[model samples]
Target: MWIVLLLPIVAYIFIQIAFCRVKSQSKYLRNVPGKRPFLIFGNLLDFLPGSIVFLDNLMGYLKTYGDTILFHDGSFSWILLSIDYEFNEFLYSSSVHIEKSDQYQFFHGWFGQGLLTSSGSTWRNHRKVITHSFHFSILLQFIDVFDSVGDNLVKKLESEAGKDSVEISQLISLYALDVICEAAMGVKIQALEAGNSEYVKSIKEMCNIVVDRVFSFISPRLYKLTWTYYREKTALKVRGFVLA
Candidate 1:
């Protein structure tokens, strides 16, 4: 009688283990009508960060599943609804439940409860503020600022060209940094001239760290804590240096 009782317990344990295994494997398994994602990376490994593999992945899925492809991006499931003419018309015509996903909350730790990351009433208020700030008249007034910055960038690029080839990425990043600093904060960065400015260095480091966090398989809460500390420390240093 003891043996019989032990057998049922053992069977239940085995079944539970099997179920757990299935659940873990289910994210990579292709149930939807599209090309199967990679076993481990799930169509993201090649496409992440600097690479343009996302286009190829989308094309592959389009060939197999038409316009709309349903796939799991790691643990997060997404519906890749194409921007075809018919789909665009359908989307615009509907007054439906169009809200940002829960996954977007992951960015809140990095961007704070800011407009881009926040939701509901907070986002609504942010939108109102931004709309007022970016009125047509305001944008028109900024046109001369844009033209002056553009001329400076072209002149700088012309000056930096070597006999061989230049590091295009670094140069473009500096140009963009300069433009953003001037446009947003009304402060000149001169990142190309100083190359290793504290603010530019910190921003580049922070960007790399954020990208690393985005691709990590760790829990979002833990990642948020780690990134928040790094971001705050780096930001304080940058702010101090900039003010000084």
Candidate 2:
């Protein structure tokens, strides 16, 4: 009976001791400033529920914390956002730190071990293979593709000039994508000419799913349970498009 009554008290004391240890360890982060992560929750409360609002909050937080900030979601993870020019150069130039972070593995389902999410020998090999495609001669050849896409974009813009303030954002996105399709994928998506492509629509949905996955605190569980449906659906559509 006494042990049962004291369970809550014992757990309470243990939690307090744990928090004290964590608070003491906070000094190890040094001059880096960020949200005060609470026990269990960490900085989960710092994140907004919606992607748009979360981005707004992130920008606001960055404004307050400067270019560099310690982003903590839980005791399990912490990311140091180093946005300064010199710091970014140092981070990317280092061969030792070439490994992608653990969080990037979450995106593996979408991109697999492709160049963007790969590391070590796999990444090195992928880089070598991809670099060949971007060789100076190959890039020079791609200039014609870029010019065609740009001309198409200009024609679309000119057509919209007489309209009451047309949105050029979609046109610009399609133009950029057209360039990428031709230069990188070795295919012509013709997204701008198509106007309403199923593949393009799927791509947009995939972007929204990615944003939700990346920004949410419960990314792993959320992705597998809810986000995975749209992700897989869109992924299948993209694959179908590529195969076609």
Candidate 3:
């Protein structure tokens, strides 16, 4: 009983100590726009209760903070979020800013060292190899695949036309998946017709897990302690098995 009682006090003390150490380093970013951060927790408390509202809450922040905002995690590691056109243009156009953020590691397990997760010379090489695939002439060949997918999408949407409300995002996603599978791999998975397949189910679940991880206040290294981590790994295995 005594040990359990003391645990909270001990944890609080440690967090305060850690926060003090990092506070000076992050002081410069305090002037930036966004919600005022709390000790140790930063802006993480705002995301609690339901992480499923992450996207909606992010939109709210954009409205409150304009284009550029600053946020930090529990560890007081500050990150600048920007949707300003000039800032994005500069970041993407500059060769010096080729490196991606550490948060991208969350995708490493599923995407491997593919273009999205790779950087530096590896990214350059991957981009060069795939550059021709997106050429106008090459993309023109996929028109039939797009038309077929669009037809399937229209048929699916027609089924939902009279409903009081319709969630079209998932429908569009399935259409894109079908098109990609058929055009890229020559495999007609018919994702729109069979969106509940284990592979597609796993893809959706894995995507949610990734988004949750990004918004989570806990450290990614500690994810092994949670059931969601195992679920994500299982989803990855399912996806890999289906792809193979």
Best by TM-score: 3
How do these models rank on TM-score, best leading? 3, 2, 1
Across 1-244, the per-residue lDDT of candidate 1 in tens digits comes to 9999999999888667755764675665455455455754555564465556766766776777776565545433443556468876886454353356546655554456767666667767787689788767777766776787678767778887764777778877887777777777788878867887877777776665555544444556566477555664665466654455
* Total backbone collisions, model 3: 0
CA lDDT, candidate 2, residue 4: 98
Where does candidate 1 clash, by residue pair? none
**Worst ten in a row by lDDT for model 1:** 72-81
Q: Candidate 2, residues 41-77: lDDT per residue as tens digits?
A: 7765666445356667777778988898887665345
Q: Which stretches of candidate 3 lie over 4 Å from their true place?
A: 1-31, 49-56, 241-243
Off by over 4 Å in 1: 1-34, 37-41, 44-70, 79-98, 167-169, 224-244
Backbone clash pairs for candidate 3 read: none
State the RMSD for candidate 3.
Answer: 3.5
In the range 1-244, model 3's lDDT, one tens digit per residue, is 9999999999999788777766775677777788877865777766654567767877888899989988775555667889999998998877667888667888887888878887899988998899888779998889999998899999999999999988889898898889888898888888899968877898888887886777676677798899988898888877554477
For candidate 3, report its TM-score. Answer: 0.83
